[model samples]
Each structure stands twice: as C-alpha cells, then as structure tokens.
Target chain A: MRSTVMYGAGDVRVENLPDPKLEQPTDALVRVVRACVCGSDLHPYHSMPAAEQGTQMGHEFIGVVEEVGSEVSLISRGDFVIAPFAYFDNTCEFCREGLTTSCEHGGFFSTAQSEAVRVPLADGTLVKAPVGDDSALLPSLLTLSDVLITGHHAAVMGQVGPGTSVTVIGDGAVGLLAVLAAKRLGAEQIVLMGRHQARTNLGREFGATDVVAERGEEGIAKVLELTGGKGTRAVLECVGYMNAYEMAIGTVRSGGIISRVGVPQYEEAPIGMGSLFGRNVRLAGGPGAQRSYIEELLPDVLEGRIEPGKVFDRTVALDATPEGYTAMDERTALKVLVRP
Target chain B: MRSTVMYGAGDVRVENLPDPKLEQPTDALVRVVRACVCGSDLHPYHSMPAAEQGTQMGHEFIGVVEEVGSEVSLISRGDFVIAPFAYFDNTCEFCREGLTTSCEHGGFFSTAQSEAVRVPLADGTLVKAPVGDDSALLPSLLTLSDVLITGHHAAVMGQVGPGTSVTVIGDGAVGLLAVLAAKRLGAEQIVLMGRHQARTNLGREFGATDVVAERGEEGIAKVLELTGGKGTRAVLECVGYMNAYEMAIGTVRSGGIISRVGVPQYEEAPIGMGSLFGRNVRLAGGPGAQRSYIEELLPDVLEGRIEPGKVFDRTVALDATPEGYTAMDERTALKVLVRP
Candidate 1:
C-alpha cells in the first residue's frame, strides 16, 4: 500500500507502506476512495523539524469498508462510508452534547492518506454515505467529513440564523464554505473579506452578498461601512492569523459574535476589555467536531443542493501526492483531491 | 454640591464642587439619593496616574428627578429613577438591538458620586423605579443600574437557563448577584468559586448549589471534579483579573460558554487554538449594558423576590467617600453604599 508521509518542513512523500488490518473488535478496514490535503497540513509543512521517522498524513477521507471486526455492528463490509476528521465513540458524554472532538474515547485520524487504513470505533466514527463510492457527489460528500461541517459549526456556534448578517474573513476553502453555510442558515447579509480575487470570486458564488478586497484597519472600516457603520452580527474567522482575529474583534458589531474555525497559529490575543468586553461582543467557534455534524449536512451534498467540493480545484494520483502538497503550498491549487 | 475625585492611584477625596446644571435639551437634574463603589472602580484606583485636575468619579446611582428639560418627555420632576451606568438616547440603532452601551450618542456617567448630576438623554438613561426613593427596595433598585443587571448579563450571555449547569467565578457584589441571577434563570447546578467565606456565604444565600473555596489550579480541578471531570456548561467570570479569565478557559466544558462581565484589566490572553479552540468553548459577555436588562430584572427586586442589596455590607456619608474606596480596595467591605 502507498501512503503520504511528511519527513520535515516542505517535505511530503508518497511511499509504499504495509497495509493495515483491523486490530480492535470495533475496528474496520477501509479502502480509501477519496482524500485531500488540508490547510492545516500546511502548518507543519512550513515549520516541522526533521525526523528519522516521519508522521503519517491526512485526516479527511471517504472510503469503503473492505472488512470489519466482530464488534462492528452498524457498519459492514462493502459499505460506503465517510469518516469524520476525528474518531470518537458516539455514546460518550461529549458526543451526546454534539461535541465529538472532546469524546472521552476519541482521537484524530492520521492514516487517511493511504490506500487502506484501520478505522477505530467504526460504528461511531464512520457514517454511511447516501451515495455510492463512484457517484459524482463523492467530492462534495468527502467534504462533509471536515470542512463543510466545520463551516456549519462556525455558523451554529456564532448563532447565525434567519436574518443573520455575517462577515466571513479569509478566502480559504473553509471560509468560502462558511459563506455557503451562513447562506444555508438564512443569513441575509454575507460579506466576504478577502484580497484574493480568485478565491473571493468563489466566495461570491457561495452566496457572499458583498466582498471587501481590503485587509487590516481598512478592511474593518469597509466591513463597517458595508453594514451601515455597524459590522455584521457574526464574523466567521476562517484564517487563524492574528491579524485576521484582530479584524474579527474590530469589525464585530456591539453584542455581535466572532466565530473562529481556524486553528490558532498564535498563542495570545487581545480579547479583554478594549476589544470584546467594551462592546459586548462574543467569541465563539472551535475545532469542527464534524463527527456530529456529518449526518446533518450529508443530505445537502447527496441531493446536490450544495457543492462544497468546488474547493478542490485540482486532483492528484497516489504517486503525485508530493506535487499536490507543493501545489497547495504555493497557492497554485485551492485544494487537491487525492486518489489511491 | 460635594463630589468624589481621584487624584491618582489610592488617592480619593470628597470636596465641595459647583452644583450641576442642565446644558442640553435632553438633560435633567437629579439629586443623588444613593451611590455605590464598584469592583471595577478599584481598577483605576490601583494604577491611575496623578493629574492636577482630578477625575470626577462614580457611575452607578439612584436619585429623585429634581428637574427636567423642556425636551424630557418620559421622566418628570419628583419621579424616583434608576440611572444606568451609561447614558444613551435609547432611540439609536444599537439601542434598538438591545445594545444600549454602544448607542451612537451614549457615554458613561462620571458625576454619579456628586450631590446632584445633570443626566443627558434623560428619557432613555433613566428608568422610573416602582418604589419611592426612601423605600428599602432602593438598595436593590440601585443594583439594577449595574451589579444586579450586570450579573444577569453574565447569565444571559452564557445562555444559562432551565436545566443549565453553571459556575460563577468571584464572590464580589457582581459575582454574588450572578448567583442570584442564575438562580432566577433556573440553572440546575450553580457552583460559586471563591475563597472569601463571608462573600461565599452570601453566595449560598443567593442559591449557590456548591461552594469551591479553591484558587487557581486547585479551583479548576475542584470544578472539574464537581462536574464529573467535564467542566460546567457555563462559567460566569465576574473577576476582571487575567488569572480569573484563565480559570474561565480551564473550567469551561467542551463546547461550553465563558461569560465574562468583568471589565478585563489585562490586555492579552491565551484564547487561541490551545485553549478555547480545541475545546469548542465559546466566550460570551461584556459590560452589562444594564440599560436593556434593568426593566426585565426590576420586578424581582421590587417584589422582594430577591435581595441583591445584601452585597452592600457597608454605608458611608458622601463626605466619607474616600474611606469607602479604601474599605473596598483593602477587601474590608464587599461593597459600600454612599448617601448624600
């Protein structure tokens, strides 16, 4: 079997590795049908230290159940499934609260970029996709494993609903999806704050009613101006950069909310009196915990009501995985769909 | 008229000053019946630089409407009114959205400690009290301007409601009132975290279901211990110190909320991926914006259903305002009420 590995910063490789087999009673063997490079994967690709033993790559994937252990009941061999970015036991207290990322017996997946991988807690971690593995909706269905649901998480956390006015920061795949999510949730005003014309164009198609091609203070002023000197009720921060967070604080209207799905790249932020407190703004959002969100958003992708997979502007075969990482890193590809 | 002034850190004095007069058509003159020192006031008293012309102090007060300008419509002379800490026209966009603190024409009141104050935006800043100026309910009604409603703000922002579990940090006036407010909102489990026995005892009276007299790590551990190893769903942070905010992040459950009504004294905080993001926790709250909350909470105070005034353990004449600040600064008093 061939799998993706990261040896150090800027080094992504596809190498032959021993095929995986179900080890636990609840485990299942999945043959990867589709996977992709995530924005977060670029984090380590930029600064990770060199090591003799590189780390396995990828967490988002849609696969077919090739084999299942004795305890796997809900899932069976030959079933098409979508695995959430994180593996969790659905019965855990946190999972019951729709917070699967914090499930008591849960952890993230790291072997999704391979031809075949062992999925733990199969009954809970894998959701049966409504469509077959070869369906045209496969790309969109794969996104429900993370980004699509994550975008929804931002909207849910920010309490974006009917009549909500929202400002989405960052033009990344997640940000663009958030625009779509906010629109699906009935947001009346969707302003995309991004300087990237190519990405912002997709954001516009994703239902962004307005686009602000400015950054920093100017971007905040434009967002405020766009909303009649009062920023949107919700600011979805999909970029983890401190400058984007600062803009989130600056543009959130009094008593509004800032929902961040971006994994923070910085340790500290100005979240005290002068920023969040004085204006009564709220700071919301976190790791997507798509395990609970997949079922809810899967229907949209299956029925072709939405096409979140538009984010994957390029695709790569197993042997070309290295080039895929480089293309994404250099911004030549929005997101790269991987085939094994 | 006598007024309280702070020349610098730890320096407070009450001196005779010219009586106030209306300068705007929306202004009204009010005789101060009662004023109180707040926990937030201690912030400036701890580090403000000295000035030749000392800053006039105080923002919370209840008084008789001595006179009204020709434009004042809702309020008239001889009416007992409760003035919110901030003054606003109440007709602005933000005000209509229930964000009175961000009113376009709003500003905080600083002459509340004086014998008389010229209140701007009288029709919007003042809410007529159901009880007379001399009634015992005055103490509780006075709290509606800040503490009591501020406490309610914490609960409301945290989404505390029937069957909700919450933890109230700090046992100061606002913290104690928060326990009362959470109780009023029907929180199922209320944990009051504070080391001060006197204040914690008052918290118990206000319906705190559990008391954790621990600080820092021990406090966070104790709270987790009480909530079955997962922190409470809502952490109402009433303490402005950074340490308290840290505990807020530590004690919030996965996907829980940290509602901070404290005027955060610090500038930076660890609110990125490692803290709020990883757990899917939401940070909500800000300046109490009681202008919108006062009316909703007034009936509880007027009907003797709750006694938020028990937080005011000490009283002083206007001439002894300086001593009041000392007593509060040294933790000798929970809160001090002043009479003119």
Candidate 2:
C-alpha cells in the first residue's frame, strides 16, 4: 500500500507500506476511491513537530468496502462507503445524542490518504453511499466525510434558520459550504468575509449576498456597516486563526451566535464581559459528528441540489499526493482531490 | 435623600444626596420602596479604589413611580414598577431581540440605593408589577428587577427544558433561584454544587435534587460520577470565579451547554480544542435581558407559584444601607434587602 506520511513541517511523502488488516471483528477493509488534502492538514504543513517515525496523515476519504470483519453487520464487501473523520459506534450514548466524536469507543482516522485502510467499528462508522465506486459524484460524497458536514455543523450550531442573516469568516471550503448550508437553512442574508477573489466569487454563487475583503478592524467595520452597525445574527468562524476569531467576535450582533468549526489553534479566547458577555453572544461548533450528519446531507448531494464538489479546484494521482499538500499550503489550490 | 456609596475597598457609607428628578423626556422619577445588595455589588466592595467622591451604588429595586416625564407613556405615577439592573429603551433593535442589556441607549443603574432615583427610558426599562410599593410581595418583585430574572436567564440560555438535567454552580441567591428556574422549566434532575449548608438547604426547597459540597477535581469527579461519567446536559455557572468557570468546563458533557450569567472577572477562558471545542459544548448566557424577562416572570411571582423573596434573608433601613453591603460582603446574608 502507498500511504501519506508527514516527517516534519512541509515534509509530506507517499511511500509503500504494508497493507492494513482487520485488527478487530468490528473492522472493515476500505479500498479508498477518493481522498483530499484538508485545510487542517496545512496546520501541520506549517508547524508539525519533527517525528522520526513519521505520522500517518489524512482523515477524510470515500472508499469501497474491500473486506468486512465477521462481526460487521451493516457494511458488506464491495459496497461504496464514506467514513467520517472519526470512527464511532453510532449506538453509544454520545453518538445517539449526535455528539459522535465523543464516542467512548471512537478514535480518529489517519490512514485514509492511503490506497487501502482498515476502518474500525465498520457498521457504525461507515455510512453506505448510494452510488457506484466510479460515480461522478464521488468528490461531493467525499466531502461528506468531513468538510461539508463540518460546514453544516457550524450552521446548525449557530442556529441558522429562516429569515436570519449570517457572516461567514474565512473562504476555505468549509466556509463556502457554510454559506451554502446557511442558505439552505433559509438565512435571508449571507455575508462572506474573505480576501480571495476566486473563492469569494464562488461564495457568491453558493449564496453569499455580501463579501468583505478587508481584514481586522476594517473587516469588522465593513461587516458592521453592511449589517447596519449591529453585525450579523450569526457569524460562522471557519478559520481557526486568531484574527478570524476576533472578526467573529466583532461581527456578531448582541444575542447572536458565533460558531467555530475550524479547529482553534489558540488556547485562550476573550470570553469576558468586554467580549462575548456584554453582547449576550453564544459560542458553539466543533469537529463535526459526520457519522451522524452524513446521512442527513447525502440525499441533497445525491440529488444534485448542492454542488459542494466545486470546492475541489485541483486533483492529483496517489503517487503525487505530496503536491496536494504543497498546493494547499501555498494557497495555489482551494482544495485538492486525490485519486488512487 | 439618603444613598449608599463605596468610598474604597470594604468601605461603604450611607449619606445624604440630592433627590433625583427627570433628566430625560423618557425618564421617570421613582421613590425607592425596596432595593437589595447583590452578589455582583460585592465585587466592587472588595476591590473599589478610594476616591474623594464615592461612587453611587445599587441597581436592583422595586419602587413607586413618583413621576413620569412627558414622553413616558406606558408607566404612570403611583404605579409600582420594577427596574432591571440596566436601563434601556426596549423598542431598540437589541431590546426587540430580547437583548435589552445591549440596547444602543442602555446604561447601568447606580442610584437605586438612594431614597429617590430617575430611571431613563421609563416606558422600556420599568415594568409595572401589579402591586403597590408596600405590598408584601415587594421582595420577590424586587428579585425580578435582577436576581431571579437573571437566574431565569441562566436557565433559559442554558436551554433548560423538559426532562433535561442540570448542574448549577454556586449557592448564591442567583444560584438558588437558578434551581427554581430549572425546576420551573421542567428539569428532571437538578444537581447543585455548593458547600453553604443554609444556601444549599434553600436550594433544595427551590428544587435542587442533589447537592455536591466538593470543590475542584473532586467536585468534577462527583458530578461526573452522578451523571454516569457523562456530566449533565447543562452546567449553570452562577459564580463568576474562574474555578466556577473551570467546573463548568469540567462538568459539561459532550455537546452540552455551560451557561454563565455571572460576570466573569477573568478576561480569558480556555476555549481551545482541549476545552470547549473538543467537547462540542456551547457557551451561552450573560447579564440577562431582565427588562424583557421581567414581564414574563412577573406572573409567576405575583401568583405565588414561586417565592423568590425567600432569598432576601436580612433587611436594613435607609441609613443602615451600609450594613446591607457589609452583611452581603461578609456572606452573613444570602442577600440583603434595603428599605429607603
């Protein structure tokens, strides 16, 4: 098997490795059909501590069931499936409550960039995709494993619903999709904050009614100006950068919500009376429980009601997966898809 | 007119001040019938800097509407009214959205400790309480001016609803009232964390089903153990201490909510992936929009469905207002009622 590994910051390589085998009766062997480089991957590309043994990379992928462990009941060999970024037994109390990432028996994915990988808790972690392995919708289906569902999570946490307005920070794939999710959930106004022309243009197509290219105070001012000085009712923070967090804080109206789906890189955020409390703002969002969300979002993707795959601006072959990391890290690609 | 003032840390004095008169066309002159020393008032009592001219004190009161400015339409002179801790014109955008504390023209009250005070934005800030200023329900009606409504805000913002379980931190007047609010909202299990026997006893009467006297890790361990190691669906932080915030972080289950109505004395709280984000926990709550909540909660207080006045365990005359502050600052009383 050829898998992705990170040796240090900016050092990504794809090399041959021993094939994975089912280590648990609840595991299933997945031969990946599609994988992608995530913006979070860029975090390590910029500053991952050196690891001599190298860390296995990738957590999002769409694959076909190559083999199923004896106890795996819901998944079968040759079935097309998408595994959420984390593996969780869907029946656990946390999972049942839609907090699947906190599943007692769950852990995250690290080998999904490989040609084939072992998925644990197969029946609970892998949701059967209603398509053939070579379907054209694979790119969109692939996003369900992470990004798209995370965008949905941000919208949901922000309580985006009919007749509300929203401010989306960051033009990353997740941010753009958050605009889509908010629009789908019936938000009347979607203001996307980003400096990227191409991405903001796409954001416009996806449902952004306004775009603020300014940064920092200017950005906050622009959003506030657009919102009649009240900011938006919901601010979706899709970039974990401190400035983005600050912008979210500045652009959230009193009693509004700031939902963060991007993994926060900073530890301390001002939550005092001067920041959130004075405005009566709520803070929500986290790593998406995609195992719970994948099913809910699949029908829309399958019916082509949403075109989330448009986020993948570049694609590469498995051996050239290293380029996918570099392209995203250098901002040369919005998102990079990899085919084995 | 006698009024309370804070000259320095731990220094409180009651002295003569000129009676207030309407300063705005939207203002109302009110004669204070009842006011109370609040937990928050103690914050300044413990850390106020010495000044040649002491700061005016008190923000919670039920008063007789002695006079109304020409523009005051909703409230009439001689009507009993309750003023929230903050004054706001409720027709403002923020107020219309139920965020009265963040109203564009809003400001805090500082002269409620005086014999008479001028309340601005009378039509929006003062709600008629359906009783005379001398009614026996004065204490409970006064609680609606701040504490009880704030407790309701904590519960409401934490999303306390039918059959939900909650862990309320602190056993202050607000904390005990939060237990009552949670029970009123149909919370099936109410776990209160506090060591004060008297306060916790009142909490029990107010619907606290379980009480944990432990603090810190042991407290977290106790709460987790009680919730089968999952914590409760909500943790109401009624104490603004950092440790109370920490307990909130520790006891909130995955995807649960930690609502803080207590004004956080600290500026930064851990909201990184390791704290709130990893658990997918949402943070909600603020000073509370009591002007908006007062009307809704008034019926319960007026109908005897709740006895929020039970929190006021001591009383002081106009000249003895200083004693009220002293009693609350020393924790000799859960809350102190001041008559002027």
Candidate 3:
C-alpha cells in the first residue's frame, strides 16, 4: 500500500507502506476510493516542526469496506461507505445528541490518502453510500466526509433557513460549499465574500446572489451595503483568521448569528463587550460534526441535488499526491482530489 | 424632586434635583415607586472620578405615569409601568426580532433613583402592570426592569428548557434569579456556583439543585463532577470577570451554550481555539433584552407565581439611599431597594 506522509514543511511524499488491517472488534478495513487535500492541511504543510517523524497525512476519504471485524454489525464487507473526518462510537451520549465530533470514544483519521486504511468504530463511523461504485459521485461523496458537511454545519449552526439573508466569508472550498448549503436551507439571499474573480464566479454558480470583492473593513461595508445598511441575518465564517472573524462580526445584523466552521488559529481573539453584547450577536459552530451531517447530506450528493465536488479543481493519482500539495500551496488549484 | 447622586468614589448623596418633565413627543414622566441599587453599580460607586456635577444614579425602577407627551399613546397618567433598564423604540427591526436592547433607538437609564423620570420612547419602553397601586408587587415588577429579566434572558439565550441541566456561574442577584428562571423553564438540574453561603442559600431557595462554592479551576471541576464529567448542557454566565467566563467555558458540554448577560468587563478574553472549537460550545446573550422579556414575564409576576423581589435584602428611604449602596458594597445585603 502507498500512503501520503509529511516529513516536514514543504516535504510531502507518497511512499509504499504496510497495508492496514482491522485490529479491534469494531474495526473495519477500507480500500480508499477517493480522498482530498483540506485547507487546514496547509497549516502543517507550511510549517509543522512536530512532524519530525514523517507523520501520516489526510483525514478525508470515502472507500469500500474490504473486511470487517466481528463486532461490526451495521456495515459489511464490499459496502460503499464514507469515513467521516472523525471516527466516533455513534452510540455514545454525545453522538446521540448529534455531536459526533465530540463523541466519548472519538478520534481523527490519519494516513487516509492511501490504498487501504483501518477504520475504528466502523459501525458508528461509516455511513454507507446509497449508490454502489459510482466513480463520478466519488468526489461529492468524499466531500461529505469533511468540507461539504462542514459547510452544512455552518448553515445549521447559523440558523440559515427560508427567507434568511446570509453572508459567507472566505472563497475556499468550504466557503463555496457553505453558499450551496445555505441555498439548500432555503436562504433568500446568499452573498459570497471573495476577491478572486475565478472563485467568485464559482460562488455565483453555487447560489451566491452577490459577491463582494473587498477585504476587511471595505468588505464589511460592501456586505452592509448589499443588505441595505443592516448586515445579513446569518454570517458563515469559513476562514479561521482574526480578520475574517472580525469581518463576520461586522457583517452580521444586530441579533444575527456568526457560525464559524473554519479551524480557528488564534489563541486570543478580541471579543469586545461593546461589539457582541450591544448587538446580541451569537457565535456558534466549530469543528463540524461531520458524521452527524453525512447521513443527512449523502442523499443529496447521490441524487445529484448538489454538486459540491466541483470544488475539486484538480485530481491526481495517489502516487503523485505531493504535486497536489504544491498545486494548492502555489494557488494554482482550488482543491486537489486524490484517487488511490 | 429628590434623587440619589454619585458625587465621587465612595460619595453617594441624596439631594434636591429639578423635577423631570416630558422632553419629547414620545416621552412620559413617571413618578418612581421603587428603585434598586445593582451589583454593576458598585463598579462606579467604588471608584468614580470626582463628578463635580454629581451624576444621577440608578437604572432599575418601576413607576406610575404622572405625565405623558401627546405622542405617548400606550401609556397615560395614573398608569403604573415598568421601565426596562434600557429604553427602546419597539418599532425597530431588532426590537421586532425580540432584541429590544439593540433597538435602533435605545439608551440606558440614568438617574432613575429619583422622584420622577423622563422616559424616552414611552409607548414602547414602558409596560403597564396588570394591577394598579400594588405596593406588595412593586419589588418584583421593579426587578422586571433589569436584574430578574436579565437572568431570564440568560436562561432563554442558553436555551434552558424541560429536562435540560444547567450550571449558573455567579451568585449575585442576577445569578440567583437565573436559577429561578431555569426552574421556570423546567430545567431538571440547576447548579449555582458561588462562594458566599448566604447567597448560595438563596440560590438553593431559588431552585438550585446543587451549589459549588469553589472558584476558577476548582469550581469548573466541581461542576464537571456534578454533571458526571461531561459538563452541563446550558451555562448561565452571570459574572463579567474573566475567571468566571473561563469557568463557564470549561463547564459546558460539547455543543452546549454559554449565555452571558453580564456586561463583560474584559476587552480580550482568551477564546482559545483549543477550547471552543473542539467542543463546539456556543457563546450567546448580551445586555439582557429586558424590554422583550418584560411583557411575557409580567403575567407571571402579576399572578404571584414568581417573587424575584426576594433578592432585595434591605430597603431604605430616599434620604438614606447612601446606606443602600454601602450595604450592598460591604456584602451585608444581597440587593438594596430604594423608596423615593
């Protein structure tokens, strides 16, 4: 088996690795069908001093179950499944409450951009795809494992629904997908905030009613102007930076919600009493409970109701996964899909 | 007319002041029936710079309408009314969304510990009590103007409802009332965190299922222990201090909400990504939308179902208002009710 490994900053390699096998009674062996590079992956790709041991990479993948341990009852061998970014024993109290990401027995995936991987808590972590071996739907299904469902989490947490006017900040794959999620939730107006013409064009296609090309203060002003001086009813903060969070705060109307799904990078962000308190703004959303949303969103992808896979602007063989990283890092590609 | 005035740090004086009159077409002049010194008032009471002109003190009051401008249609002379701590023109978009504290035309009350007050937006800001001249209910109705309603806002914002478990940080008047509010909302378990035995006693009386007297890390650990190590589903952060906020963050379960009605004093509270993002905890609530809750809560107060006024541990004449401040500041009283 071949797997992606990060030796250090700017050093990604696809090397032959020992094949994974089920170790626990609840574990299952999955042959990877599709995988992708995440925006957060860039953090370690740019500078990860802790990766001195050549760490296994990738947490997003969809595959076919090749083997299952004795305790795996919900899913069987040869079943097409989506491995949500986090593995969780869906029977836990947290999982029962729809917070699978916080399940009592939960852990993140690693070395998923490989030929085969061992999935723990298989019964709870794997959501069988409705269709069987549909190569064209692979990208979209893979997205449900992380980004698309993450966008859905933002929309749900922000309470974006029928007649809501939403402003989505960031032009990354997650932001674009949030636009689609908000649209699916029946938002009346969806504004995508992105400066790049190419990304904004894709945003328009994803149901953004308007696109503001400004950044920071000007971007907030543009969003406020677009919403007639009062900011949007819901703001999806898809970027985790301080400025992006500030813009989300500034672009949401009094009493509106700011749903942040991006993996936040700041240790201390200014939460001025005068800002959040006076306006009664709500802050919700974090690491998406992707497993909670995968089942709900899987049908949409299988039925072709939404094509979130369009975010994958490039696709490469598993052996060439390193180029995929460079392509995204150099801004030549929006996202890279990996086929193992 | 006479009013309580803050001349400087530790200097509170009751002095003769000019009578207030309706200054705007939408204004109404009310003769105060009851007023109370709030916990927050101590912030300026203990360290106000020399105020040469002597600023008028007090923001919590219930009164009888003595005069009304031509435009004041909802309230008239002889009607008893509760003026929310923050006056708002109920016609604004924010007000329509039940966030009157953020109304486009809204302002905080000042100099309310007086014989008369000129209330702006009278028709929208004043809620006429169901009964007239009921001095026994005066204290509870007065609380509707601020503290009690603020606590109610905390419960409402935290989404405390039937069968929910809640942890309330702070044993101040607002925190005590939050316990009552949580009970009214049918919360199954209410934990009140405070070190003062006297205050915690009142908290238990107000429906606290448990009391954790520890502060900081110990307090959070106690709460986690009480909730079986998973933390509570709802947290009411009634203290504005940074440590209280941190404890609230640490004591909320995954996907739980932290409703903060305390006028947060910190400009930059540490909202580390490691804390909020991974657990998916939500932060909501602000300067209690008091006006929004007054109408809905008035019936309960009028029907003698809830006695939030019990929080007032002492009462003082208008001339002895300074003693009221002293009583509260020295911890001799939970709250002080002032009769002008």
Best by lDDT: 2
How far does residue A203 in candidate 1 sit from its true spot (Å)? 1.4
- Report the Cα lDDT for residue A184, model 3: 95
The TM-scores, one per candidate, come to: 0.98, 0.98, 0.98
How does model 1 score on DockQ?
0.87
In angstroms and one decimal each, the interface RMSD of every candidate reads 0.9, 0.8, 1.3
Please give the lDDT score at residue A9 for candidate 1.
Answer: 98
Q: Write the per-residue lDDT of candidate 3 for residues A1-340, one digit (tens) a residue.
A: 9999999889999988888988999999999989889998999998887556789899999889999999999999999999988999988898888888898899999879889889999999999986667678888888898889999999999999999999999999999999999999999999999987888898899899999999999999999989999999899999898899889888998888999998887867766576676678888998885576887888888789999999999999999999999999988999999988
The digit string of per-residue lDDT tens for model 1 on B116-186 reads: 99999999999998677779887888898899989999999999999999999999999999999999999
In model 3, which runs have C-alpha deviations exceeding 4 angstroms? A50-52, B132-134
The digit string of per-residue lDDT tens for model 2 on A1-340 reads 9999999998999989999999999999999999999999999888988888888889999999999999999999989998899999989888888888999999999888899989999999999977998799999998898889999999999999998999999999999999999999999999999999999999999999999999899999999999898899899999998889999999998899999998999988999999998778999999996566788889999999998999999999988999999898888999999998
Please give, for residues B253-279, the per-residue lDDT of candidate 3 as tens digits.
Answer: 889999998878786776657777778
What residue pairs are clashing in model 1? none
Candidates, DockQ: 0.87, 0.86, 0.79
| Global lDDT of model 1 | 0.90
Clashes of 3: 0
